[model samples]
Target: MKKILLLSACLSIIPGTTLAQNTTAGTIELDMPGHFQRQSVSFDYVRRDVMIPMRDGVKLHTVILVPKDARNAPILMTRTPYNADHMTSFASSGDMSSVLEGYDNMTDVIADGGYIRVVQDVRGKYRSEGRYVMNRPFRGPLNGTQVDHATDTWDTIEWLVHNTPESNGKVGIIGISYDGFTALTALFHPHPALKVSVPMNPMVDGWIGDDWFHNGAFREENLPYIYDQDATPKNDEKWWSNHYDAYDLYLNAVSAGALGKSRGMEQIGFFRQITAHLAYDSWWQNQAMDKLLVKEGLTVPTLLVHSLWDQEDSYGAVATWYALENVPTSARNLSIVIGPWNHGGERVEASKLGDIKFRADTGYYFRKKILEPFLAHYLKDSTISLPARVSEFRTGENIWETASKLPAPDCASECKALHLEPGHGLGFTIPGVDAGAAQYTSDPDHPVPYVPRPVLTKGVTGSPWKYWLVTDQRDVASRPDVLTFTSEILTKPLTIEGEPLVHLTASTTGTDGDFVVKLIDVFPDQVSAQPEMGGYQLMVSADILRGRYRKSFEHPEAIPANTPQLYKIALPFTNHTFLPGHKIMVQIQSSWFPLYDRNPQSYVDNIFFAPKAAYKPATISVDIRNSWIDLHTK
Candidate 1:
C-alpha cells in the first residue's frame, strides 16, 4: 500500500504525468498516466483514419495523410490487401518519408509535392469488414455479387473527391504486385476524379506467366504464399517449414497436393483451387487481367512499369502493354517503363540486383524522371510533358533509351534466328550437319536445383528468391541433365529488344516432361572491373513449359513416348545488349526443381496429386538441327 502511494506521488510530481486512485477495503490502486502525445516536434502532415464504405455496404479501412498547407491538392491512392495501418505507419517519426517508406507511395512526391496520400485495405483484409477472395473476380460469371475491386474503387474515389475538402478532386491510383492488380481494376470503371494509374509488376495472368504458374509448370515456391494469404482473414498464419533445405522438403513430399496436405494447406481456398485446376481452364482464363483489360480497353491514362529482373510477375506489365497497345484508345493513353530491377524494386535503391549492376540507381531515375513527371502531368496538371510511349533501361549497355513505339515493327520483321549446332555451339547460321540428338537422363529423384543448394524456403529472411533471376547460371550449367550451348566471344554488341521465341524439337522417353529454356549472357573470363562477376553466366530470359500443354494450354495430353514433338516457347521480353568480349549462351534442361514442381515422367490425371510411383527417370533428346531461338533484334 505504501509502495503504491509512493509510486503515485512520484508519478504525480512528474511534469507531464497524472495519477488516479481507487480504494477498496483499505487497499489503494493507483493509475499513472503516461504521455501519449509528441513533445516539442510538430508533424508537417495530418493523418486521418476512416472506414470508407464500399458500394455493397462493406467499409474498408483507410489511412489518409494530408500536408498541413495542402489546398486543392491532388489525391494519390493505393488499394492493397496488405494491411493499411502497418503500411501507413512505416516509422515512429512524423516525417512523411519516415512514414511512407516503401511500396508505391512515392515518398518524395508525396512529402515535397503536397499531394494527399491515401492507402486502404481491400475487402476482408485487416480492419475491413467482408469475406476475402483471392484476386476477387469481376462482378459477372466469376463473382455473383455486384461488388468487386472495380466497384469498390469507384466508391472509394467517389467518396474521396466529395468528402476530402483539401483535394483538387483529381485522383491517381498506383501499386505494385497484387495491389497493382487493384490499380488496374480502377481503369475498368474509373470515377470522374480518377485520372491516372500506374501498375508496377502487376499480376496479369497467373496461369500463363505470373506468380502461381509460368506457362503450364506450376511455381512451387508460391504454395506457401497461398497458405499464408488465404489461410486466414488477417493473413496471420505463417508458413512453417520443417526442413532447412526446401529441395529435400519438396522432393520428399512427392507431389504439390501431397505437400499441401502434409502442411495442412488443404483448408486454404486458393490451394484447393490451384490443385483442382491443373490445366488452364475457363476459371483462370477468365481472370487473366491482361485479357480483361483488353476487353475494357484503356479508359484512363495508364503507365505500366516493368522490371527486367523481376522474379515475380515479370510477364504482367509487358504482357498488359502488348495486349492493349493495338487498341486505338490505348495508343494515346498507355505508356510503359521497363527498368533493371527486381520485383517491386522501383520503390527502393536499385543500383544492383544480385551479381548484376545497372551502373546507376535505376529505381530513383525511373521514379524521378519518368514516374513522377507522368503522375504530375495528369494529377497536378504540371507543365512537364510525359516521356515517350516506351522508356527502357537497357542492361549491358547500362543506359536508358526512349522510343515512341515498342515491339518495334522493324525489329520483328528483321528478327534473327540463333540455331543450336552440333557439339554444343550457338550461332546465327544453320548447322551444316544434322546432329542426331543431345541426350540426357532427367531423374525426378535428382532434379536439377534452380539455384545452388542448401536451398532455403522462400519468404524467409535472407532468402535469395527476390534476386534469383539475376543469380549466376554457372551453378546449373555443369549438370549433365542440362545441355549447354555457347557462342564465340562477341566482337560487336548484339541487342535483343523484344521477346525471344524458343523453337524446340525434343523427345522424352516417358509420357510427360517439362522443358526449361534459358537465354544467358556469359561475361568475359576475366572482368577487370568486378572480379566476382568474371565468367558469370547471367540468364537474360527463361521460362518452362509442361509437355502436356505443348499443343494447347486448356487441354492436357500424354506425349507419345520417344517421339519428337515441336515445342515453341515465347521467353519474356529482354531489352539487353550482349556487349563485345561477352558470349551468348543457351541452356536447356528438365526440372528446375523446388522453383517449379517436379513433372512426373509418367502422365497422370493431375500432377498435383501424382503419387510416389509416378516419379521416374526419363531420357530427353533434343534435335539440334531443328532447334533454334528466334530473337527480336533492334
Candidate 2:
C-alpha cells in the first residue's frame, strides 16, 4: 500500500522545470500517463551470467535482460565495473523495475514505451574473469601500455548482438561515470550494431588531470574513499575486509586532529603509493581515451551528460564533447546537458530543500521527454524526433532555459588585467582606491577546512563550492596566506562561456605550492547554513591547479625562494550568466586541508616521503602585473 502511494504521489506531481528549447525539429511526444504504477506493468526477465570473450582470450562477466514476450528487440548495452548486480538491485526496486525488467540492464524510462538490456562487468572488476587492473588495458598482458578497455567493449557488443535472442542487430549503449567510459569506448570501434550511446560523466582522460588526478595533485581525499568503495578486491574476503577498512579510515581521517595518524594507516599508505607516481608518465597517460577516440573515430550518434557541480569526474564530460565533435563522421552526434547539482544529487532532489519547498520532479521529465525519444528513434526506428540541444533545470530560477549553444563569453570589451599587488586585496585599483591587501595564513598543520568533506584524503572534495555558499571567507581573508580578489559587481549581466585562464607572476618561499582558484557568484544576503544547505552564495564553478607541474605535467622543478616565475593555470571553464546583482569573487589559497594533501615548504623528492618535521609555513608573494584571470565574456 505504501508503494502504491509512492507511485501515485510521483504521478500527481507536475514537472515545473522548463526545456532548453521550445521547438525541436522532428521531436515526437508520446502520450505518457501522469504516473506509472509498478504493479500495472509486468515483464518476465532472465538473469544469466556468461563469459564475454575478449581479444586476449580472457572472458568478461556479462548479464543479459530479455523481455519474455519479445521475439526480436534491439539491445541496449552497458559496460560497467561497478557491478551489474548493483544495477539489478536498483532495477528490482518499485518504479525502476517497470523500466529495467523489459530492457537490458540499461535504464530506459521507456520500458513500457520496448528493448533488451545488456550489462557486462569490465575486464577485471566484479564477476568479470580477468584479473582486475585499475583502469588498465582490456587486452594483452598486464605489461602493455598501448592497450585500452575500448577493445574489450567492442568485443562484448559483437558477442551480445550475435548471441542474444531477438536482438535486431542494433545496439545502443549508456552508463554514468566509468560505465560511461565503457560506452564511449565501444563507439570507438563503430560496430555495425552500435547505433546510439549516452556517456554521462565518462572518463575520457586518465591522467590525474582529467578525473582521477587534478593538475598532478593527488585528490588525496577522494582517491582513497573511491578506491575503498569501488575498486574490486583480490577476492571476497579482501573485499569485505576493505569495506571495513574504509570505515576505519574515514573515522580516523575526519577525527579532527588525528588526520595523519589513524587505524586505517594501510589505506593511507596505499594512497601514498599510488599518488607518488604523479607525473603524466606511462601509468597516467595510458588511460586517456580522447586521442584514441579521435584516431579510431565514432560511427554512432551520441549524447553526453554532465553536472556543472559534478565533484568526481568533471573533466571527462566536457573534454570528450570537444574531442568527439571534431570526428569526421556524419552519423556522429553530440549533445551536452549540465546542471547545478552534485554527482548523484540530480536524481534524488525532487521536492523539499531542507524545510523549504521548491518542488522538483527529478528524473521524470528527462526519462519521459528526452531519453525516451532518443532511444525510440535510434533503437526502434520510431518517428520520435529531438531538439538539437536540451538543458533543463537551474537552481535559483527553478526553471529550465533553452539555448542553441552554451552561453558565450562576455568578451565585448578589451581584456582587462588586475594585478595581485603584494598588499592590495583582489580588485581593480581605482587610482588610489587601495583596499588593503587581502591575507590569510595556510598552515599545513592547521589548514582551512574544505567544505562538503572530500572523499577520504586531505584534499578538495567533490564540490566545496556548495559549502562555501554559506561560510563566509571574510574571516579567512584576514589571515596571512589566503588571497581574496573580487571584481566590482557588473553593471550589466555578464555571460561567461568557455574556459578561463589564470596568469600569475609570483614566487614562493617553498619548493612546491598549490594555487586553488574558485569562481563564485556572491549572493545578496547571508544566512545560517547547514551541512546540506550552505546558505546564500551559489558556487557556479571552481578548479585547482598544482604549481609544481605548471610548465609540464611529466616533470617538476623546485621554485627558488624569492625568484619570480610566470605561471598560467587553466581554471575550470563554466557556462553561466552572472546576473547584474551578483558579484564575481575569486579566492586563492595555497592549502585546502584534508581536501588536498599539505605541501611541505621544503623541496622534497616525493611528498609521501617528506618527513613530518618538514611541514612548515612559507611566505609567498604574488605580483599582479602579469597575474589575472582572463574571463571570456559575451
Put down candidate 2 lDDT per residue, 152-186, tens digits, no spaces. 76788788877887778888888877777777777
Residue pairs that clash (backbone atoms under 3 angstroms), model 1: none
Query: Local distance difference test, per candidate?
Result: 0.89, 0.60
Worst 10 residues of 1 by lDDT: 16-25
Q: Pick the candidate with the highest TM-score.
A: 1
Each candidate structure's TM-score, on Cα atoms with residue i matched to residue i, is 0.95, 0.77
